[model samples]
Structures are given as C-alpha cells and as structure tokens.
Target chain A: MYPNNLKYSKEHEWVDLESKKIGITHYAQESLGDVVFVELPEVGAEFEVGDSLGVVESVKAVSDVYSPVSGKVTAVNEALLDNPELINQDPYGEGWIVEMEITGGEEDLLSAEEYERLIKEE
Target chain B: MSQLKRTPLYENHVKAGAKIVDFAGFAMPVQYTGIIEEHNTVRNQAGLFDVSHMGEIEIKGKDAGKFIQKLITNNLEKIEPEKVLYSPVCYEDGGTVDDLLVYCHNWEHFWLVVNASNTEKDLDWFNKHLKDEQVTIENISDNIALLALQGPRAQEILQLLTTFDLNEIRPFRFKSIDIAGVDCLVSRTGYTGEDGFEIYLASDKACFIWETLLEKGKGYGLAPIGLGARDTLRFEAGLPLYGHELSPEITPLEAGLGFFVDLKSEHDFIGRKALEEQRAQGIPRKKVGLEMLERGIPREGYPVQKDGKEIGYITSGSPSPTLGKHLGMALIQSSEAEIGNEVEVIIRNRAVKAQIIKTPFYKKEDK
Candidate 1:
C-alpha cells in the first residue's frame, strides 16, 4: 500500500506538502529496477508541472524523472549521487529526490486510496 | 497492431515474476530478480538463460559446405565436422546481415544459428542467393528451443542429469547427447565469455528442461537470468550484439569483427569484395572501448564527441556489473579511436568525459 496523507500524481510521484518533499512512489521504483545513477536538477531551477526534471539510470535503461507539480527547485537530494540504490531501498523516506517551493497549487492530484485504485486499474 | 510472440518458456517467465518487455517483436523477459544480480551470478557462479528465441536454420544437401561458404564471411572449409565457427553474414555492400554461429555437422549437413530478429530477413537472403545451388534450407526457429547454462560451475550442475562425459564437448564443439533421457543437442559454447553449455531440444520439452536445470542448479548458486543481464554479460566480455554492434549499415570492419570475416579466403563469398576494398582503402571509422572519466552510465545511440565536435556514437554501453565501472564501445573515426585517447559521451544532454580503454573489460581466467 502507498503512504497516506501525501498527494500522488498519475505518473507515480508523491509529494509531502508540509515539508515540500517529493519523490517517486514505491511502484515507480519497483518498475524502474535497480537505480545505478540519479541526475537531479540544480537548486534555484524553476519548472512547470509535469516538466522533465532529471534522469534515473538503471542497469537496463534510462528514464526521465518528471516533476509532478509546478515549483521553484529549493534543494536536490545529494545522497543519491553516490548511492542511487537508496530509491529502491526506501522509496519514500531516504529516497526523497527534491524539495521545492510551490508556485502552482496542487491540482488534479489523487489521494492514496485513489492512487492505489488507479494503479490497480493499470 | 501485431501481437508479440512468446517462446515456450513464456509461462515460466511469468511464474518467476520476470519483467517482460517487447524485444524485436517478442515478449521476452528483460530481467527477473535484477540485472546486476543476475549478471554477477553468471560471472562468479552460474546462471540459466532462455535463448529459445534465436533462429536456427538447417541445411541438408551434398553441397551444404559450398553453399555455406558462399554466404557467410568466415571460411568453413577448415572448420572440422562437429565444430562451430563464428561468422559475420554480410551483404554485398560489406554491411553485416547478422553475426551468427555455423555448426558444421558434416559435408552433407550444416546448422546455422542466427539472430532471432533477423530470422525472416536472413532466410529471404539465403533463398534469394540460391541461384541453382543444390541445397535445402529449412527454418527450424519454431521447432527448436535453446537454453544456455553458463559459468564456472556450469559443468557440475549439468552433469547431474546426463551420464555422458561433458568434457567430450570442448569449447566451440558440440555433441548430440541425451539429458534426463531426452534427446538433445548439447554444445560446449556460450555467449557469456564463461565455460558453459547450450542445450537445444524440442520446443515442447523446453519448460521441463528449464525447470530441471534451475532445480538442479540451485545449490550451485544458479539463477534464471534475463535479457537485461544477458546484454551486460556480453558487453563486458566485448562480444558484439547484432543490432547494436553489427547491423545492416555497420560493416564488420568498423565493428572490429574482422577476425571472423576471413577477408583473405580463396573462396568467393558475398561482401568479400566490399570488405577487401574497404580494408585496402583503410577503414574510416572503427570500434573502440570507452571508460567513463566522469560520472554517468552511457546508453546506446548517445553521441561521442572529440573537442566538442561530434565524432562517433556509442554502439553498446552500460554499467559493467563485473568491472564495477561505467564503460562502453563506440564507433568513431579510426584516427580518433586510438586507445588512451580522451573522448566525451553525451549522457542525458550533458557531455561526460571518457577515455578509450582496451577492449573486453572482463575476461575469464584460463582453466
């Protein structure tokens, strides 16, 4: 089950509104396989919702990590530089990818129950 | 849209929780547990792979040897019966049709194992060039199933079911033997750059053989590997994959597969003239090994640059599980491809520094 009380995007990204933390969901990490490298956006960068923010390289393929909400990038996770497998080990806690100041309010985001329902439908 | 094809081991892949992807129109397992794990398993211990999708062609005729010599680039006259020879099946323009293994059963019969994606095209090419040739070509891709058990411990695990001496089949040699009392063709050859065997049996018995191997090989740290690890294993060993390293537009010379081409052979073969001409004129571009100087794992189709000018492109690349480093092979101008020369690879729109290194990032220790 996905963590509750977090806004979820259909793209399998989760946001903790209180701390402005964002990371890919457990389902995303599972589907992506073992993460070999993580390329994060520099702090102070601005992006619209659903913008391509960075990339995650796995042993098999490279995938773009998209921003789920519009925001000004405040901090990017540096822990993943040396230990990208943190995303696979703990997708929600130690795997948080970025912190941002919300410039555009949450819109069309789903709750945990809705996100779980959506994934089941897939 | 057409439906994706599945091998006889499709059900087994699903039961094992494999991540299936569409590879060359076939729904194949790209990874099971994980790519890095499965890759290391083959490097240190042993691993099993479902290579049933590879196409096999059987040639039965009095002129089978002559027919083979005319088609592929490698010389078959010197290849002994019961031995296997690797060849780059080339086109008239010197471009590679596919890199395949020719199993010389005898003068009257030969077997060709070709790339699965190139099966239809290869068959068409073979038939088109018959030109009154006295040989019968049969497509056995669907009837035959293949499983490769590879690693240092491969012999011990496979010896459990067969009483025949596995040592009889030397590297690049094959023997028609019985396993678990079932008739099968066993070959002492593998693509993983390790000591192993390739078992070719009836399609119906594929699942049974696969399960049996996994069950018998469990104690030896054998795991079911997928295409993800398969690519990594072959890349680390500097073996060329058909589409990535050799293709219709990529010549064997540029791919560094000339050893298998037999350019100086007396036999007249397809693509011989073109390759000879290319060799005399000096190959413009060639393949070289690359080790990442900066961070970032290089991926295929990415550009390679020298002094900010695009010079080449990565043919095959990944995080080498065995070497524990980011490395790749690139096709660049022969002049710029010298070993130890520095080049930059474009990874995710950023240029990452990489140095050309000696090929074959990993090699198996001699027995």
Candidate 2:
C-alpha cells in the first residue's frame, strides 16, 4: 500500500514529513525477498542526495540504501541491526531506517500518486 | 536480457506466487514462501524441487564404456549397471570442465547428467574428443524433466506414489518404475545431503507428477522449494557448486575433491598428466572453511587476507540457515589453510576477522 502522507523516491524509499523518518518502500522489500542483515550509517554522518547511507543484505544478494535528501543523520535504527527482517515485514512503520533534519533535495521527491505511476511504467 | 527459457513447471511456479529469476538461461523460481523457511522444511520435513534445467546426455554404442573412460577422472572398473558415479570432467590443463554424474546402465549405454549452464560447452567438448570410437551421443535434456524430493521424510512421501518396493533401490542406484501411473527412472540420489530421490520422466508429464506429489505430500509437511533454498541447503551440506568451488581456473584436487580423482589408474584420462604432476609437486592452494569471528557476512568474490597480504578469495559464502553461523569457503594458499588458522575477509573495504574451521558446517545425524 502506497500511503498518501509520505513522499516517495525513485529508488524505492519513502520519507515521512512530520516524524522526519526514512524507510524503504513496500516494493523494495518485496523485490529484495528476505532481509538478513542491515548496515546502518553512523549517527551524525552528513550526506547529500544520492549518497549511500546504509546497506541492506538479503539472503542471496546485497543492496545499497541511498539517501534521497541531503541531511545529517539525527538518529539511527538500532533495532534493524539485530532483526533486519523488520524491513520485509513492515517497511513503512517499525522498519524505518533513520531520522534526519531535511536540508535539501525536496524537489526530487515524488507524491504517492506519481510514484505509483512511475513503478507501473517500470 | 535475451529471451530466457522456461521449464515445463514454470506456470506452476507462477501460480504458486514464486519469485522468478533468470537461472542458467531459464526463467526459474528463486523462492516461494521464503528462502529460510523453505530451507528449514527440507531439513526437518520434506520438500520438492523442479530441477528440470539440468542437462542429460545419452551415450550408447559398443564403445560407450571405453569412450567415457578417457573423458572422466574417476575409474569405472568397479561400475555396474543401474549405478551412478560422481566425477569431474577436466580439460587438458587440469582445470575443470564440469562436475557431473554418470548413470551407468550397461557397457553399451550410459547417461551423463551435467550442470545446466555447462550443457552446451560439455556437448561441444564431448564431440571434439570423439576419436574412432563407436559411441553415439545425443543431448536428451529437452525431452526429459527432473524433480527431486529430498529431506528426512522424503522416503515416506515417495513410498505412497508407487507400488514398486522403493526399498529395493539403494543409494546411488536407479530403477525404472511407475509413479502415479507415469513411467520414470527414479534414483535415490540428491544434492541436499539427505535421503531422497531424483525422478526423471517425460517432459509433458512433469506438471501432473508435481501436482500429485504436492497434493499427496500435504499431510507429510511437504513444501515446494526453489533455487534459493536449494543453494543454501547444498552450501550448508558442504557440497561444491561447479562455478564456485570448481571452475576453469580451479582443479578438483585443489578444491578438496581428491577422493574422486584416481591418479594410480592404468588408463590415463584427460588432465591426468597435469594432476599427477601437481600431486608430485604438491598442491599449491587448498580449499578451507571459514567461520566469522567478528560481525559481518562474508560473500563471494570477497578478498581473503593474512597479515595485510592478499592470500586468496572466497569462492562461496552465506549465513548458514541450518547452522545459524556466518560461514564461507575460501581457496587460499595451502600453507595458510590449517585448521584454527586466523584470517580476515575483506568486506566492503573492512577486514573482518575469521578462523579456519572444519568444513561442511553441518552434517545430518546418523539414522
């Protein structure tokens, strides 16, 4: 379910406005199959849009989680380090990866309607 | 990106909500419910697999036995009809051409079951070496379909299908029998290191047998497994995948498969000279098992190091679902392959500490 409240990125990541939290989308989790390990960026790490912030490893392969918006890592998801399958079970809620103070790249985000259309075209 | 081939059971996998991926030019299912769960099913209960992508070649003639004697590494003097032999076909330089199973029916006819990806190359190699032998070879891969039922409960599930005494066939032996009304060549052999059978039948009859097995096996806790769990199961069992453990750059002896290589046989096979030479000179590299001492999952192609110098690389690695440990197999220098030797796996530019441990990671308790 693509929620209307969150803005989605072309890389299959979603961002929440009120909580300033970031997480992968449902499509991402489904495509990854099963998440076995998570590598989170250090707290206070600064990065720009398109920079790799963390990593998600599945049973067969590994994928990089890219930053959709430029910001400093305010908080990290410690729970994912122990239980990475949270990303596959609930990618939008408890599966949130990091929280940050939005700095730039706001125009690059797409609405839920536009993101749905983009995935359809893919 | 080219047109991928599909097995006969492709539609069945799609209908069961499987994640399809390209495997050796075939559109194959990589997972069904999940890899870990499916892996567990085969260890604790029973699981079915559509291994139709494997290649089967038939050789029949007066010289069929003698022709294969020069092609494979293992000695066939002790072989009999209805028996299977696992051996590696090598090149002139002692590198691996492929690892395959030879199903011996008699002196005049035999079947070679090879890896799916190596089918074309193996066929070409087999043809190129044909000297004045009376052997006639044919590729029967497309006409046949293979299905494996493997696990602790595999025997119980398969016994309900056929009236033939399944107990009559021993491990590494095959018998032609009627299964659910279809005639099939069933072998009590598998790659999962369990008590199981690999059934070979007509291509058209694959779907019917698949459905019937799943239907009847419902009460026995049988589930459909995919390539993902198939790989993990084989890896945890310490089986060598062709491309990973044995390859064109790797020899069977270096991969720790010296048991299958017969160096003292009177008949000289391909690569025998090189293998003998290597044996005389001492094998330079050895395959060893690595267990992570620090946090991090080792993966294929990762560099292995000792004292800041690159020693070798990981051929295959993953989190063992059955053993619940981060494990890997590496082809490193033989001097550094001793048990309890400390090493490092360079993951993402960081060296993760690991220790050399006894291989196979997991073994089934004796029944």
Query: Which candidate number has the best lDDT?
Result: 2
Q: Write the per-residue lDDT of candidate 2 for residues A17-109, one digit (tens) a residue.
A: 789899999989988888998999998999899899998988888888989899999999999988999999999988999999889987889
Give the lDDT of residue B254 in candidate 1: 92
User: Which CAPRI tier for candidate 2?
Assistant: medium
Best by TM-score: 2
lDDT (Cα, tens digit) per residue for candidate 1, span B1-367: 1398889999999999999998877889999999999999999899999999999999989888889899999889768888999999989999999989999888889999999999999999999999777899999999999999999999999999899999999989999988987899999988898899999999999999999999999999999999999889999999999989899899999999888878675899999999999999999899999999998887789999999999999999899888889999899989998889999999877899999999888999998
- Lowest summed lDDT across 10 adjacent residues in model 2 chain B is found at B1-10
TM-score per candidate, chains pooled: 0.98, 0.98
Show pairs that collide, candidate 2.
none
**Candidate 1 lDDT by residue in tens digits, A5-97:** 799999888998889989998988888899998989999999888998888878876888778889999999999998999999998889999
Chain A TM-score for model 2, please?
0.97
Candidate 2 at A50: error in angstroms?
Answer: 0.9
- State the DockQ, from 0 to 1, for candidate 2: 0.75
